[model samples]
Target: MENHKLGRAPDFTNACIVMFGVNLGWVLLFLFAIYGLVAAVFICLIVNHWLNWVAVRRRQADQLYAGKTPG
Candidate 1:
């Protein structure tokens, strides 16, 4: 029975190289997914900052001109 069980065990050692290849492919895919998420967040932050800056500048300009000006 022991011998039969041993024989039935998958010969993963023999197919180790293929398994390693598959594992590496998954690792690269996971890394790329993480990189994409981080990049998207970074882009969102930059755009948000730019919009805030523009709004502040516009307010400042309005305040500066609110005081009688005909030039």
Candidate 2:
């Protein structure tokens, strides 16, 4: 005989469901405020420069490979 009452899981198991009232924007602002604004901007600029450099390198590699490889 199979018992149906033992088959169900607990409702309060997920942590996200428990924090339903939290606003993520406020949390982000709190983090940014704890860190200085100038530092944040400098980090963003460095990341942007790195991403652009990588994209340029990838483009050059693609062009070089495209010319040599036969389809």
The whole-model lDDT of each prediction reads: 0.70, 0.65
lDDT of 2 by residue, 22-71 (tens): 55445445657988677556666776798899988888888788885422
Residue-by-residue lDDT tens digits, candidate 1, 1-71: 55654436577785896887688567656756878667656655776798899988888788778974322
Model 2 spans with C-alpha error above 4 angstroms: 1-31, 68-71
Clashes of 1: 0
Worst 10 residues of 2 by lDDT: 20-29
Question: Quick one: best TM-score, which candidate?
Answer: 2
Best model per lDDT: 1
Instruction: Output the TM-score of candidate 1.
Output: 0.46
Least well predicted 10-residue stretch by lDDT in candidate 1: 1-10
